[model samples]
Target: MLISDSQKKILSLLADGEFHSGAELAEVLGVSRSAVWKQLNGLESLGVPHAAVSGKGYRLSRPIELLDGAKILDHLDEQHRAKISSLEIHDQIDSTNTYLSSLARQNAPSGSVCLAERQTAGKGRRGRQWISPYGSNILLSILWRFQHGPAAISALSLAIGVAVIRALRRLGIDKAGLKWPNDIYSEGKKLGGILIEVAGENEGPCYAVTGLGLNLFLPEEEAGAIDQPWTDLGRIAGGRPIGRNQLAGELIDQLLKVLTGFEQTGLAAYLDEWREYDCLCGESASVFIGAQQFDGTLEGIDAQGFLLMRDADDRLRAFASGEVSFRRAFP
Candidate 1:
C-alpha cells in the first residue's frame, strides 16, 4: 500500500523513537486526535510495531533508520554519480524489480534504479516470496542494458553476490558470504538474496533488472513467515550500530563498479572475490529440481557461475538451475 502524506508526516515525527502526545501528533498532522489514533493503530498493518503509553501517546517499538536518497548518494563516489541515469525511492511499492523493468521497457537508461521501503508483492527465485518488514531491509533494483544479451552475463547474479560481500566487508561486517547461484549467507543463515531478470533477443541487445533484498533488521514478526534459517545485520553486527544508509550506498557503488566492467569481462572480473567469499565450496548439500533431488557434495561454481556438485555416484555434475539446501549448517 502506498503511504499517504499524513502517514509519512506522522512516521517522520515518530521515527525519532520518542513518545509524542496524541494532541501534538494531531496538531502537527492537521488531523483530529481520533484520526491520529487510527493512523497509529494502522502501523501494525505495515508490520511496524509501536508502543502506546497511557500518558506518553505513542512511539515506534524501536529506533529505525529510514532510507534517505541524499544520505545514500553521499556515500556514492562522485565519478560514479553520473553513471546513474535515474534514481527513485518509494515509500511503498509492489516490487522494485517489477517497477524498474517497466521503466526498462520504456527505454530507461542503463543505470536506472528503483527502491522501496516495503514491497507488497516482492519476488524471489523460482516463484518464491521475498518479504521485508516496512523500512527494515533494503529492497532495490537496477536496470542495465547489455549489448550482447543473456549469454554475456550468464554469471551476473553470482557477480552481484561478490559485490554484496565486498560492501559488507567495507562496513566492518566481514563474515557475510555467498551461497551459490544467489543467496547471501553468514554463519549458516541467510542474510539476503539476488534475483536477476534479463529480457530481449538472445543474441542482441537486452536489459537486466538486478534485484537485491537484504535484511538489516528482520523483526521477529516478519521472521515467522520464513521457512529456513535466516539472519539480519542486527544480529551480525553484534551490538555494533547497523547503519542502513551506509550499506545501501556501498551496495550501489559496488554494483555500479561491477556493472561498468562486467560487459567487457563477464564474471572473470569478479571470480576471485566471489571465491574468496564462497560459503559452500566443498559442502554437502541437496539440489532439488522439481520432484527430483540430487544428494551431493558441492564442488564450488564453474567459470559461468553454474553449481558444480559431486553426485553420490562420485561423478561431477554442473547444474544451471535448482534450489540447494546444505545438509548441515556450517559456520
Candidate 2:
C-alpha cells in the first residue's frame, strides 16, 4: 500500500473534485501521460474514487481535505505547540499506534504525534479491523511518557474519551457522547473509538500510545465492512466538510490538556465532566465474560473510571473492562 511521490502529487491535483486532462496532469507533474495513467490506475487500491470521462478527463468522486502537518501546527496555540515534541504525517502506514509504540521503545519523548492518511492494517479495540480510506478520516496516535506505571493510568482512556468529545464540541458537534470505556457515539450511532497501548513497568515509568479512529466520510464499500451501526462526523454536521488539519489540531490540543491534567490530579478531576456526556449512564447494560454474563442498570462511572452498575440483588458492581452492550428492559 505504498503511495509513491508521483501518486501523491497526482492525488493533490485531483483532490479538488474537478477533472484534469491527462495531458494537463502529465505536464504539471513533469511526467509522461503513461506515468500519470499508471498512478491513476493505482488509486483504487488506496480506496480513492474517481471518474474517467472520455472528453472531461479524470475527476474525483468527492473532494478530500488532506492532512497538512504545517497547517496543523499553525492551528495550535503557543502553549499547546510547545508541548508537542514532534508530529509526523504519512501517506500510508500499517498503523499510527504501532508506529508510535515502536518509537516509545527507543525512548521517544512525550507529546509525539503520528498521523496517517491510509492504514492497510489499522486496528481498533477488541481486535476489530479499523476501516480507513485514504484522505477520508482521522487516524492518529499520540505517545506520552508517564512517571507512574501503567496501573496508575487506568483512567487514561476515559480521559481521552472526554478530550475527543470536547474537540468535537469545538467543531459545533455537541451531540457526541461517550459509550463506557472507549467508544464515541453520535445520535446513538458509533462515530469513533479509542485504543490505548502501554509498555513498561507496573510501578514506575511507562509509555502509552493512544490511538483514535474517527469516521469522516465513509464510502459504501468501506461502510459495508463495518459490523455495527456507524455514523461519520460529516453526516452529523449536515454534510459539511471539516478540514482534517483543523480537526487534528483541536484533538491534539484537547488531548494534551487532559493528559496534563490527569498527570497532575489523577482521574478525580474529570469525573463530573465525563458524566455530562456519559452515553450509558442510565441504560441497562449486559456484560459477557466467557461463559458468564451479568446484567445491571448503569449507575454511571465511579471516580476511578470503572463502570458502576447496580445488579439485580441491589448490590453495586464495578467492572474494569469487558464486552458490554446496552439494552432496554421491559417494565
Candidate 3:
C-alpha cells in the first residue's frame, strides 16, 4: 500500500526514536492534531510499531535509519556514479525487484536503481516472502543490461554475494559470510539475501534486476514474524547505530563494479575472493530438492559456482541449486 506524504514526513520525524506530541507533529507538519493521530494509526498497517502514552504522545518502537538518495549518490565514486542512469527513492512499494523487472521489460536504461523505505510484498528466493519493516532495512534493486544471455550470467548471484560481503567488511562487520548461492550470514544466522531476475531473449542481450535486502535493525514484533534465525547490523555492530544511507551507498558502489566486470570475467574473477567468505565450506550440510534430500559434506563451490558436495562414499558431486541446511559433520 502506498503511504501519503504526511505519513512519510511523520516517519522521518519519529526515526530518531524520540516521542512527539500529536500537537507538536501537527504544528511541525502544518496539519491538524486529528490528522496527525490518524496518520500515526495508519502506520500500523505498514508494519511500523509505535507507542502512544497518555502524556508522552507517540514514538516508534525502535530507532531507525532511513535511506537518503542524495547521501547515497554523494558517496558514490566518480566511475560508479557514471554507471547509474537514475536513482529513485520510494516511501512504499510492493517490491523493488518487481518494480525494476517491469521497468526492464519497458526498456529501462541500464544502471537504473530503485530503493524503497518499506516493501509490502518483498520477495525471497524459492517463493518466500521477504519481511521488511519501515525504515529499518535496505530494500534496493539495480537494473543492468547484459550482452550475453541468461546462461552467461547464471553465476551472477554468487558474484553479487561477494560484493555484499565486501561492502560489509568495508563497514567493519567482518563476521558476515557467503551462504552458497544467495545468502549473507553472520554466525549461522541470516543477515541479508539477494534475489535476481532476468529478462529479454535466450541468445543475445538480456537485462537483470538484482535485488538486495539487508537488515539494519529488527524490532521484537518483526523478529517474531521470521521463521529462521536472523541477525541485523545492530547486533553485528554490538548495539552501535549503523548509518543506513552510508551502507546503501557502499552496496551500490560495490555492486556496480561487480556487474560491470561480470560481463567480461563471469564468476571466475571473483572465485578466490568468494572463497574467503564461504560460510558452509568444510562443513556438513543437507541439500533439499523437491521432496528428495541428500546428506553430504560441504566442500565449497566449484569454478562455475556450483556447490561441491562430498558424500558418504567419498564421491564428489556438484549441484547447481538446492536448499542447504548446515549441520554437524556426519559420523
Candidate 4:
C-alpha cells in the first residue's frame, strides 16, 4: 500500500531538524497518538530513517532532501502556478514519460510532472536506449496538453533544450549549449537530451510529454557503455557532484516557465535564445537524412525550428526531423 496522507505529513514535519513528541504531533495534526505511531512505522517501512527518542518522540536521522513539490509550486509565478496540477516522485520506474502517458490517457491535468530517481528502461528519440543508472541522473517528464496541431509541436524539443540550458546556467554552469532537436552540450560533450512525444491528432488538441535525462555523477563503468562522448555535472562543476534534488527543482522551474510561453507563441518566439546558445552554429557538420547524408556548414535554425545548413555548393537547405547525427569537421 502507498503511504497515507498522515504519514506524508509526518515525514514533512520531520523534514527539518525538529522533533515532536507523539502527543504533541497527534494534537497538532488532529489525530490520535496511536495513529501517529502507525504512520511513523509506515515511513520506516518506506526506507525513511528516523530515531524514536523516549522523551523526544521522533527525529529524522538526516533531513529529507527530496524535491518538495509544494516548495516548487510556491516559487512559481502567478501565470504558471495555476497550470501545475501534481508532482509525483518515484524511487524507480521503467520510464517517466511512459508513466505520465498513462495518466494523460486518463485525462490527467496539464503540467503534471513525473520524476524518478532511477529508470530501468529509459528511452530517447527514435527508440534509442537512454542510459539511466540508479541515483546518478535526473529522469523526469512533464505533461503539457496543447491546443495546437501536431505540426506546431515540432519545435517543442527545441524549447525544452532552451529551458535546460537556462536552468544549467542558473546553476552556475554558463557554458551549456544546445545541439539541434534535443541534445544539450558543454565543451562538445553531451550533458543531456530531450525527447518530445505527442499523443493526439495533427489538427486536434495534443498532449506532449517532454522528457529529460541529465547526467549528474555517472559511474565510470556506466559511462563507458555510452558510445558517444558524454559528460556529467560533476566534471563541469569542478569535480563537485551536484545535488540531484536541487537540479531537479531547477529543471522543473525553468521548464514550467518556458512551457507557459511556448503554449502561447509556439516555437518561433524562442528562436533567438535557442540560436544564441546553439553550439553547432558556424561549425562545419553533416546531417544524415535516411539513405542520404548532407555535409555542410552549420548556419543556424530558422524561426520555424528547421536546421539551416549551407552545402558545398553554397546552397542553403532546411532539414526537418529524422535520424540526423552531428560531427565536427577536421581541418
Candidate 5:
C-alpha cells in the first residue's frame, strides 16, 4: 500500500503515542475533521496500530521513531558524514536494495544510502519475502563501488556481517553474533539479515548494493509469516530503549568503512572478527543448494569465505553459496 503524504503527516503527529483530538489533528493537518478521520483510518491498512477514545483523540499503540535523515547524519562524525554522497529516507517503499540498485545503474555515487520506514516488498535471502511492518524496524541499503572483481570480494558479505556486529557492539549489545553466509543472531534467535547484490565487469570495477533488515519493535501481528524463531533488538537489549536514529547512523558508518577499504584489505582484515561471532562453527545444520540438501556439521568458513562442512561420511567439503538452516540438537 502506498502511504500518501497526508498519511505520513498523520503518522508523524501520532508517533508520540499521545492522543490528538480530531479538531487538533485537523487544525495541524490543515484538513477537515472528516478528512483527518479518513487519514487515521487509512493507517490501519498499513498495519499501523492506533486507537481513539471518545474523550481523547487518536494515538498510535506505541511511540515510533520515524526515519529522519538529519537525525541520522547528526550521529555521524564529520568524516563519515562527508563521505556519504546522498541520503534518502523513504516513508515507504518496496525494497531499499532495489531502490539503490536502480540509482547505482544511473551512476549514483558510491556512498549513497537508502532507508525506509516500511517496505511493502522487502527482499530476503533465497527468494524469501522480508516481512517488515510500517515504523517497526530498520530497512537500510547502501550503494558502494568496488575496484576489485567479484572473486576478490567473495567474502564481502561475511565482512559486512562483521561490520554489522561492530555496529551493534557500539550500542553495548554484545549478545549479537553471526549465523554465517549473512544472518545476525542473538541468543540463538534470528535478529537480522544481509543481502549484497553486485554488478560489473568480470575482472574490473563493480558496484554492490548492501541491504540490511534489522528487527527493532516487531509486532506479533506482522510476524506470523516468518518461519523461524526471531528476536528483535528490543528483546536482545533486555527491553532497554534503543536509539533507532543512532543505530542507523552507526550502521552506515561501520558498513561504509568496510566497503571503502574492502578493496585494499579484501577479507583478511575482517576474517578474524567473522570467526569470533561464528555461531554455527560446530552445529549440525542443513545446507541447501538449489534442490539438493547437505546435512553436516558446519566447520566454519574458509579464508575465501566458502562454507566448510563435514558431512555424514566424515568427508570435508566446501560450498561457495547456499542456504544454511539450523537443525535441532540430536536426541
Candidate 6:
C-alpha cells in the first residue's frame, strides 16, 4: 500500500518507540486529531498494526522492519559513505531520475538518493518506457556532482554499468553482463537499465542524476509491457526476494567507490574490467548511428570506450555513440 508524506511523517514520529499522543501528532502535522486517527487506522489496514492507549495515544506495536538508513550508513567506511547526505524513499513517483533532478536543481547534496517502490512513468535511454511494478522492481536515482566537463561526464554511464554488474555478482548473479553504455543483461536478456542526466554549465561543476531500474520479480500481467526478453533477480536467485533496501544501499556504496575512481581516470582506468564482462564483444552486431547502419563483428571497446567493429570486407571501424543490437551472424 502507498504511504503519503503525512503518513511517513507520522511513521517517523512513531519510530522513536515512544507513545505520541494523537493531539501531539495532529499539532506536529497541522492536522486535526480525527485526521490522525484516520491515518493511523489506514496504516493498520496496510499491515502496520499499532496500539492505541486510552490516555497515551498510538504506538507502533512493533518497530517498522523496513530498510534501515542508519544501519546502511553504519556499514560503510567513513569516506565513501559520508558522500551521501540524504536517502529518501517514496511509495510512488513519476520517475526517480525526474525527482532527483528536481532536487539537484535546488542544490540537494551529492549522493542523495531518491527511491520509489514503483514509478508511474519511468524511462530509459532515448526515452524508452521502463516497466516499474510496485514491490517487484527497484526504481532509484543517485544525485552526484562532478567538477569535470561534459566530455568527462559522457563516460559516467559506462562506469556505472560496471558498478551495477559488480553488485549483481555479489548477489550471486554471476552471468550478468553489460550491454554497451548502460543495459545490464543476463542470459542475453535485459535485467536492468541505467539512465543518466546532467545539469549545470558545460565545464563547471555538474550534477549527474544516475537512475537504476532493476527487475526483482516481474508481475505476470505487467511482463508483456517489456519489449525484449528480460529476466529478474528472483528467478536467478532461486525465488528469493532480495531486500530492495539492502540492494539499494549496497549499490550506492559500490557506485560511490567506482565513481570516485572514474572521476579521476575516466573509462580508460576500467577498460580491462569492462572487457572481462563484455557481453557483445566477439559477436556479430548492427550499429545504428543516425541514418547510416553498419553490420559488423564486435571486436572490442577501445581505450576511450568506443565500440570497435570489423565489417564484412574485414575492414575495421570504430563507433563512438549509436544504438547497437547484438546477434549471431550466419556464415
Q: Quick one: best TM-score, which candidate?
A: 1
RMSD of each: 1.3, 2.0, 2.1, 6.9, 1.7, 7.0
- Candidate 6: stretches off by over 4 Å: 1-68, 71-75, 329-331
Shift in Å, residue 327, candidate 6: 1.8
Model 3 over residues 45-139: C-alpha lDDT tens digits? 88787899879889998777778889998868999999999999988899999999988888899999999988888999888888877887899
lDDT (0 to 1) per candidate: 0.88, 0.88, 0.90, 0.79, 0.89, 0.79
For model 5, the superposed segments whose C-alpha errors exceed 4 Å read 329-331
Model 5 misses residue 240 by how many Å? 0.9
Tens digit of per-residue lDDT, candidate 4, span 73-118: 5555576667678889876678999999999999997899998756
Q: Model 6, range 1-331, lDDT digits (tens) per residue?
A: 5777788789878865579999999999999999999888877544456799999999986443244567656546688777878888777688889999998999998888787766778988788898855444678788888897677778778888888887777777787888886889887888899998887888788888999998876755667867778888877788665666667767887788876677788887678888888888898899998888999899878887888999999999988789888885322
Better of 2 and 6 by lDDT: 2
* Candidate 5 lDDT over residue span 1-331, tens digit each: 7898888888888888998899998998899999998888888878797898998988998888888899999878788788899999988888999999999999998999999988988998877899888888889999998876777777889999999999999999998899879999886788999999999987998899999999988888889999988889998888899988999999998998898899899888988889999988999898899899999999998888889999999999899988898776422
Error of 3 at 277 (Å): 0.3
Which has the higher TM-score value, candidate number 1 or candidate number 4? 1
Tens-digit lDDT track of model 2 for 1-331 = 6998888888899999999999999999999989888898899888897899998899888998789998988767789889899999999999999999999999899999999999988999788999978999999899999988998898999989999998999988887899988999876688999999998998999988999999888887878889888889888899777888899899988888877667778888878889999987888889776767889999988888888889889999888887778885322
By lDDT, the better pick of 1 and 5 is: 5
Q: What is the TM-score of each candidate against the true structure?
A: 0.97, 0.96, 0.95, 0.77, 0.96, 0.78
Comparing 2 and 6 on TM-score, the stronger one: 2
Best by lDDT, which number? 3
Q: Which has the better TM-score: candidate 3, or candidate 4?
A: 3
The residue-level lDDT of candidate 1 at 34 comes to 96
- The residue pairs found clashing in candidate 4 are none
- Per-residue alpha-carbon lDDT of model 1 for 4-108, expressed as tens digits? 788778888988899999999999999999999888777778888899999879999987788898898988999777799988999899899999989889999
RMSD of 4: 6.9
lDDT of 2: 0.88
**Clashing pairs in model 3?**
none
